[model samples]
Target: MQHHRGRTRIVGALSVVVATLAATLVPTVAANAITGADFDPGHIISDLQFYDNAAMSEAEIQSFLEARVAPTGCVTSNCLAAFKMDTFTRAADRNICTEYTGGSQESAARIIYKVQRACGISARVLLVTLQKEQSLLTATAPTSWQMTASMGYGCPDTAPCDAQFYGFYNQVYKAAWQFKRYSTPDPWGTYQPGNRYIQYNPNPDCGGSWVNIRNNATAALYNYTPYQPNAASLANLYGSGGSCGAHGNRNFWTYYHGWFGDPEYGGLPGVTVTRFDVANRYESSTRISQEAFPSAPVPVVYLATGHNYPDALTAGAAAARQGGPLLLIDGASIRPVVDAELKRLRPQRIVVVGGPESVPESVVQALSAYSPSVTRVGGADRYEVSRSLALTMNPQGPVNEVFVATGSNYPDALGAGMAAGYRKVPIVLVPGTDTALDAATADFIRRLAPQKITIVGGPVSVSPGVEAQLKTFAATTRVNGANRYEVSTNLARNLYATQRPTTVYLATGLTYPDALAGSVLAARKSAALLVSHPYCIHPSTLSAITDFKVNSVTLLGGPVSLAANVKYMVRCW
Candidate 1:
């Protein structure tokens, strides 16, 4: 349990180990003398885009940590033990909940997952630090000293080690929270993209160098350690005494490389389309989707008429799951963007959603020029069209879940559809009236026999009668708010109740074109779409921003659809 010359140790036996560390360990300050040329700004420690652009779910983080084999020193030969230690639960307001999974909550993996999500920090980086600072991760039986100062966060070389920060949860939570604070823009914040003066040792004699931090994550690491490794120090991985060089940052880089390849991973391919001044909303929506998912020779593509919302409401999930984009068309002639996108995609099959009235036969025939395998899934009406699309996408088997939205309105269904898309579930269109479900919808519900039904919108959009009818088919839960803005917020909250969304998409509630196309992209990005007014953001949407602390916001459409001032407000929020 002794805190050696440059390493922090966590012992199981608290009192005995603390005395041992205090008596045996002499405070050793490592020098950080290095040249500015030694630094590579492009070679970041971690890429924020990896979290923002990629679909990093809680399950993914847990699985990654659990997959690692047990290190050399664990007494039980358990890798998860490395992440677990006794902690004062309520100390310093660090109340980590025990309940992560259902029934009986347990496991160190759960604790790491919760803290990582809560602080918006990567779990990969946390584990690397635990290993780098203490070797507690691989120790035969970690001492209380190592567990207490698990992250070596508060135990700086220049000052006395803080006693109040003792305990596993406190160390990890505070350390992760500090990393987040570093990324933030403040006068004291050091982890911004710029050249930072890092010292090798606390002593002025041990000169340091200026290193250019490429990204926030790399800058965050520098802010934590305030040092850069010299060539001599990095030459030997385990050796300590070498020309007054820091080992913390060096070990972190090496450990991360050995375990997870490159820490700065790639992001999803991004594309942007120009908003034409004369082009209608339908054309704009199609163009946006086409640019977003520019996969050539796609297997399938979803086509929905842009005049109404019902048919397109449920198409997002299916399109996202299939790695396809959602395209909007007029009732008769195909929009220029639609026609151009169809040519670019060259999909094997085009699935036209909606009735003949919504998307006419002429449009279906016009699609023959692009692909020979064009298939129309039109129904008797909008409700029937939704049913047909659902049946086609999910098939006639037991579905995981289904979303029921008011067929009459667009706002409730817009956000609901995006959520369903992200969840990869089917959404059914129900009558907006305060009455029984439509025959087509009811018949489809009975046929598919879903496990859960999420009804979107208030009583006016989807009445109690529909809820009762849905309950007979599956476990029903209604998500409603005072208005469409509130309803969108509620939908986002329900979908990502436990974790924050990777990014948020803000589109105008007055129009459907921007969000309709953005929904498919949002699902692919694993993001939440929140609809607001053209001029200002709703209070409910603002509440969501505060709750989740969402920093990334992508404004759908141009200033006309969502005002520039509104976009600014949303982003600043």
Candidate 2:
């Protein structure tokens, strides 16, 4: 039944042909061909039993065949199989008269339907098999022997075809029965799941791969042809390029796709999404932490200044290490989101990471409502706040590494936050657009004595003088981009080297609060946090998502903060 010419021999669970093709082989002229086997191996070819064959009439199959214009020059609606297939009374015909509608011409469609019902095989399978084996359906001028072995029922390449199974009715019925037998249990059955050593070609030297058969239809195809297309064969569509590769299965896929759209239609693999529904980013972070760290108790939650970016900028590292989310609050009082999350988390202690000025004493009093133990680590200004937070997180000694960003702007700091959090290293803020490092930041950097320091933004945000000063304390490395979006994408790429995260978070790059709170959430899940515009995804960010193959994306804020179109564009990836 394999589409090959000459010297066919059955050798140890393989049906192979030892001769060359009959020159009729040609490449299918089509665009968007499946150049590679990227599809899931378990994909179903078709739902064989999904079609209602009983409702199908002979007139329908005949009309369908007649409508298809043949490859050879022939009169419209006239072909050899349609007009002259039923020349003799076969075993299928007797049953067709008894069970199916009795016909006088013994039409081609009637034989196919009778064989389909008789052997419990699909008519579509028979039609495809017929064309595949002998080009019977599309060939305008076929030889008498071609019709005799229309389905290649009894043809063996080693010898002449067995004459007993000659004629269209016998061929179709026997072929359908053979396909049915493949699905049944037997010692000779090749359609079974397990490690199957399928050869790439008839030549023993060509070698093969171990394929794990997942379904009956794919098994049947392999059982019929007994060869798989190798990588070289697939590289060029026209032919195997003399590299001893089989084309039967490859042609089957190509033809099936051309005839019908995705052969594995409804059985494709699915993506998984983990969602967090909260009133704001405050609750969003807690919900994210709760989901990500389900078993971790005694979490060390970081309380940051919601009004400004200073306190929150340096808190990512500590929160990540403690397996907790950043809880943002107003300078005066605790937000309800933080209050509810505190009760839910029931942390042993809270590390408030800002000064009394940045996070007032009233907020500290309100935090004590949930936890009896609350420690405040802050200073007189933003730079001192960053220094105090770092020192508190690493009280034993100076940390080995730290990320430095502009205290005035949120983008650069937020861009570097998630990565810093993942590494559990603090983010120290420097004065933005300043000619030199402020006295507090400089003094703090000299004390910490970090081995490595990453400058997040360009010279415009943190000047060369500050970077040079930072270099005096540590091995300074700058991560700069043309803009904020590029910076975020570059940082994400560096953080998640080869790991493709299933979930990623997206927030507007133009603003900060949404992304500031979102950074901790994304870091907790070991996911990437990307920044984009309100209405559109940045090109570089979108490219990263596609390359990573991220399944689901969490938009940090509502439509106002991150526009509806941004979510739509991300989901499209």
Candidate 3:
């Protein structure tokens, strides 16, 4: 995020000559400074093109000029003549016009007139420094005429052609905001940091050369107001003082004299100074939050699976044994399965990991066979399963933590889950990809040490090496096949339900039908089910659940379906 600028002896020699000439020949125009009335839109455009050929295409420049002349009610001739003469000094000393190089300044003021009009701060303020220090108009000078390069004329060998002007502009903008917070007066218009400006100089105590320039400039511009030094203010605004070094230094008045020589030069009309404040604001805020992470609370996670499939059953059981909630979903049979699990595992929450296609027929028949559980069913719909689960886990309250082990393609859902998990721990991804997990994911998992890891796809999708590594961490991991109902049910029971529930159902066959049969039986028992076959319900079956008042649903791998018995329960009597 930090940019470096180079300074060499050659820039120093140029600085002396430019500064001497600027001091002698640049006659002080009227002290009142040219206002908007004096500028012409046409003139601004012509002059901008005249000084910098690339300026016309810059949107910021166009916008700025258009706004200024729109109100003046003047055409190209009058507007162009007035703006050129007043701002550029009739093109005789075109060097006074400088191009903004910093991404921010360049973005804000593509053209000098645009910058002036938008900021209500003068381009002259920036131009004066460019004229005295870098001779911006001269092609002979290096392209690093930008204020972002470095302090002084000498470009450093490291960043020989970088500009540092935008960096300074960024500092001032931040200072303006901070000042706005504490005081009503617009600091951007008057308050200047002169003391800290001197301190930032590499040789502040050597000869007071920078100080003299600052003082003289302030005197000539704002008549030298009684300004005190505030190092903390500068640091807070510009991020200087400690390890950040000169780039972080906001002690403007002390660091550079080019800013305050003429009030007319300092204030441009079109530029919105606030744009530069974004970088500092974002950095400072993120940094402070990162520092407070260690003291946060911990969160509990629940893993769920489809009914009776040995693999999923094994994974869920392992998770439950590790003190994490493991639930099984089998269509309308989920309640009894949940009840049974509640008695055995006694988890605090429940979560369903598979999709609607996994809903079991026996479970649906069992629901149809019973009246009380049927009444609570509220008609099975894919959305209902997800909604019901959401209500059960959250229960009109905010969830502090959530961990999703779904596929990588579900970025939106993954992001939401990660945000929830962020309250207590960082979001980490276990090795689910065929290739090794990237550094970021590995690092996050290492940091979190989550008690339970959910595998969205079957074990086949997860690298064996990753699974082995996860087992070594002493964390319980649950692997679920691709079933939306199972996924949603498991998540809900673990996160929102009044109490965690678990029930085990044995699948007789390893094929898809057996998995469905087990899921039905588990559902009949009111327990969350975990299955490991592709025979889960179809997407239509899953979508039908949206009509019901069910909870959340998670669809694992693929190939889904709903049997006739399960359809009866999902559709209701």
Ranking by lDDT: 1, 2, 3
> How much lDDT does candidate 1 score?
0.65
Best by lDDT, which number?
Answer: 1
Per-residue error at 294 for model 3, in Å? 58
Error of 1 at 53 (Å): 25
lDDT of 2 by residue, 116-186 (tens): 65666656566656665666556665667667787776665445777788877777766666665566555
lDDT of 1 at 114: 58
Worst 10 residues of 3 by lDDT: 271-280
TM-score of 2: 0.51
User: How many Å off is the CA of 350 in candidate 3?
Assistant: 77
Span of ten consecutive residues with least summed lDDT in model 2? 13-22
Off by over 4 Å in 3: 1-16, 19-110, 138-201, 204-573
TM-score between model 1 and native: 0.51
Cα displacement (Å) at residue 387, model 1 = 0.6
